[model samples]
Target: MGETGKQVVLTYEGVKKLEEELEYLKTVKRKEITQKIKTALSFGDLSENSEYDEAKNDQAFVEGRIALLENMLKSAKVIDEDDITTDKVNVGCTVKVKDVEFDDDIEYTIVGSAEADPGKLKISNESPVGRGLMGKKVGDEVEISVPDGIIKYVILEIKK
Candidate 1:
């Protein structure tokens, strides 16, 4: 669905969310699109039917999303909460770090890409800062290169 054999990593909560979305797309969205198509078809002249064209486009988009969700779910590898450890920064672990340059403290929850929400401080494990912090214990200093510049951070704590 994505790559030939690329695995989609997700947390249990992430998996649940995806499943719920897939369900909604398959049931509610599909029905809504079908109703729109039926209504457009009843309007007559297919050659000048902008409503029909728009409904078809919406149907196509919904179908594509359904396929994508199915593929992602099929390839999902859900991380178990019980498997999370505080020995180091890892997926499912929340790590606190102090910015060495600005003297600011921030907490980030390392999650799989599917569950990453930067606004909420849930960062993808593949992100620069997350990658730099991985396998690092408390007191470890890390320097990560971002688009802006290199940021230096000292690990303060790690917890599940």
Candidate 2:
């Protein structure tokens, strides 16, 4: 059966990244993992070969990740950045904000759940910043409470 879930709306960039990952997994990564398994099998002793065991574990993880990506792709609904018309926050918007308390400027790209990367400042729609930023227009100030503190930000720009 197909993916049984609501379709996730991913930004154009997010979808592109997913596509790239899928390509790499199906091509380069798959081959590399298969070779690893094969080489480990040559060591013999399926029950005692540490290399074989490690390779099997790695294979399992890789296969699981592949399945997950395939499912997401199956259920993905790619959102066209150009079609989202608004000065407000959106999944594809790169928001630049000035901290209310610390007086620091931070930039983030709002994306779907699969694309969250806090270190890179790409937040998921389910995140505090992403949720707070959504539907807020430029110049609109919003408060988001993080594990650090409740930080405030002004919506700078929303782009396609």
Candidate 3:
């Protein structure tokens, strides 16, 4: 058994990325890239063939990525969007925050690292800000000390 019986909370975006990558690997990359390998191999002497070397390298990388994605998908526990609520902070919940100092408001979805895109305001569970907001409720305050400084954030809203 795994260390934690609880399932991992993953955002829809995170799941999509994995699914897309897996599909691409099994369909497009596998067939097309493997063909590249076959074509390169047909060139005969592979010892000094740059084309063969590059193709082999690319093939290795593609296959390795496919294997990795397969493993992750096998162990995946996708979090349902319906499981999120505005009552309390949790993974998949879009958290609206207010900077207590600068009086600025920002919204972010607390998701797994795989789906976290800072520019998109998606935070990772491992992030300090995300950690501080976990299990918090609206109107609650959370303080996190970042590299810049310690900033206090107030929970404005939590949504699915």
lDDT of each: 0.90, 0.80, 0.80
Candidate 3 lDDT, 1-160, residue by residue in tens: 1123334446667777888988988899879877987888888888888988887788889888877666665666777878777789988888899999999999998887656788989988778888888999999988897889898999998888
Off by over 4 Å in 2: 1-6
TM-score of each: 0.93, 0.86, 0.84
Give me the candidate number with maximum lDDT. Answer: 1
Pairs clashing within candidate 3:
none
**Count of backbone clashes for each model?**
0, 0, 0
lDDT of 2 at 31: 90
Q: Rank the candidates by lDDT, best first.
A: 1, 3, 2
Q: What's the distance in Å from true for residue 104, model 1?
A: 1.3
Q: Write the per-residue lDDT of candidate 1 for residues 1-160, one digit (tens) a residue.
A: 2563788888888889989999999999999999999999999998999999999999999898888888888888878989998998889899999999999999999988778899999998888988998899999999999999999999999998
- Root-mean-square deviation of candidate 3: 3.3
Candidate 1 residue pairs in backbone clash: none
Reference-based lDDT, residue 126, model 3:
70
Q: Model 2: which residue pairs collide? A: none
Question: Taking the tens digit of each residue's C-alpha lDDT, what string does model 2 give over 11-125?
Answer: 7777788889988888888798889889988888788888878877877887887888888887887778676766677777787777777888888888788878899998887
Better of 1 and 3 by TM-score: 1
